[model samples]
Target: MEFIFLAAGLIMGLGAIGAAIGVGLLGSKLLESTARQPELGPMLQTKFFIVAGLIDAIPIIGVGIAMYLIFVVAA
Candidate 1:
């Protein structure tokens, strides 16, 4: 039904917004820390990448599900 497509769009949109906010805040803090501690830049960057992956995981899954719902289920 049309509702299914709407639900999929909401899921994808909300997930993207949440992920964007989380990553933006996290990266901002990480940059601030790196600026304060230049010597630890490498270590901070490594951890930032790890955390970025974790933060992105859920939204990526939501995108996949949304694609499935929009293309397969709704079709």
Candidate 2:
């Protein structure tokens, strides 16, 4: 039972860390690209938001799975 909690924690923690790193790198590249081509800033911003949402979905899914483990499996 305790191990189930640990597993869920690990899943959520790692998922969050992975998403953070991905978004950080994505933002860094977006800034670099926009700086290099200011005229394309708007287009780059649009793409960045789309990709950011996709990146964020990873952690949201992780949270849902974690909840399932804690409530359904552990219970």
Candidate 3:
């Protein structure tokens, strides 16, 4: 039980950090792409947002699960 919470915490924290870094790098390139193609700014921005949603999905789930384990299971 203790190890489960510890592992979940580590996974959630590291996954969130990795997701943040991935999103930052991807967003930077998305910005560069938009700058290079002004007319496609809206389209590219939408796509970037979609990608951001995808990138966040797992990390958010991990966080929620970790919280559940910590509060409910640990309690």
Candidate 4:
């Protein structure tokens, strides 16, 4: 039980790091695309928000599970 929880904690932390990097890279690309085609800025911004929401969802779930394991399961 302890090892499983420990591994999950490590994986969740690493996942958070990767998620942050992924969102940063995604925003960078979105900026470049918008700069290249200024007229499509609104469309790209909307799409970026959608992708950002998707990226956030996964990490949020991982964090919630991690918290539950640490606070509730370990108790």
Most TM-score-accurate candidate: 2
Q: How many pairs of residues collide in each model?
A: 0, 0, 0, 0
Let me know the TM-score candidate 2 reaches against the reference structure.
0.98
Q: Evaluate model 1: give its TM-score.
A: 0.85
Residue lDDT tens for model 1, 1-75 = 899889998998999899999999999999999999999999999999999999899889998999899899988
lDDT of candidate 2 over 1-75, digit per residue (tens): 999999999999999999999999999999999999999999999999999999999999999999999999999
Residue 12 of model 1: what lDDT?
89
Which scores better on TM-score, 1 or 2? 2
lDDT of 1: 0.92
Clashing pairs in 3: none
Better of 1 and 2 by lDDT: 2
TM-score per candidate? 0.85, 0.98, 0.79, 0.80
Off by over 4 Å in 3: 67-75
How does each model score on lDDT? 0.92, 0.98, 0.89, 0.87
lDDT of 3 by residue, 26-65 (tens): 9999889988999999998899989999999979888888
Model 4, residue pairs in steric clash: none
In terms of lDDT, the poorest run of 10 residues in model 4 is 2-11
Ranking by TM-score: 2, 1, 4, 3
